[model samples]
Target: MDTIEWQDFERVELRVGTIISAEPNVKARKPAYVLQVDLGEFGVKTSSAQITAHYSAESLVGKQVLCVCNFAAKSIAGVRSEVLVTGVYDDENRVVLASFEHPLPNGSRLA
Candidate 1:
């Protein structure tokens, strides 16, 4: 694995956000959801996520997730994805979101 300096890692804008809304991204070739997350001072951001294998739109609401906030925005499945909702690929090749057990203030930086 490539090693990165602490500063390099710190430069990544990883923050916490709460899922305020979620809906199916019907335009996507693969099943996905368009999510609106509340990032406190950073404001609300949207993301197109393929996490339907393990999550439902109803189950996703109020869930706090970690996100890469600094990445450039991209249009995914007809949605303007503004942030990267971080997750890991499970054995089934489904995305399992990176989540926190404890409640955190929105926009809290991941250290």
Candidate 2:
């Protein structure tokens, strides 16, 4: 794997955020959800995620997950994606969220 300098890594804004709402993204070709995340000082931001294989809209609410908060907003499946909810692809190729065992304040930066 290519290695990045600490400064390069630091440029990424990885933060903690909680899912306040989630709903189906009917316009997406593949199954997906539109999520509104509460990022504390950053306020609520929207994201389009293809995590329907393992998560339900109801199950995602109140769940805290790691996020990439500084990425430029992009359009996805007719939705405005403001943040990327971080996760790893499992054995079955489904995304499993990167989450904390203990609750952390929203918008808390990863040191």
Instruction: Report lDDT per candidate.
Output: 0.97, 0.97
- Which regions of candidate 1 deviate over 4 angstroms? none
Q: What is the number of residue pairs that collide in model 2? A: 0
Pairs of residues at least 3 apart in sequence or in different chains that clash in candidate 1: none
lDDT per residue for candidate 2 within 1-111, as digits (tens), equals 999999999999999999999999999999999999999999999999999999999999999999999999999999999999999999999999999999999999999
Q: Model 2 — TM-score against the truth?
A: 0.98
TM-score of every candidate:
0.98, 0.98
lDDT (10s digit) by residue, model 1, range 1-111: 999999999899999999999999999999999999999999999999999999999999999999999999999988999999999999999999999999999999998
Error of 2 at 93 (Å): 0.7
Q: Distance (Å) between predicted and true CA of 88, model 2?
A: 0.3
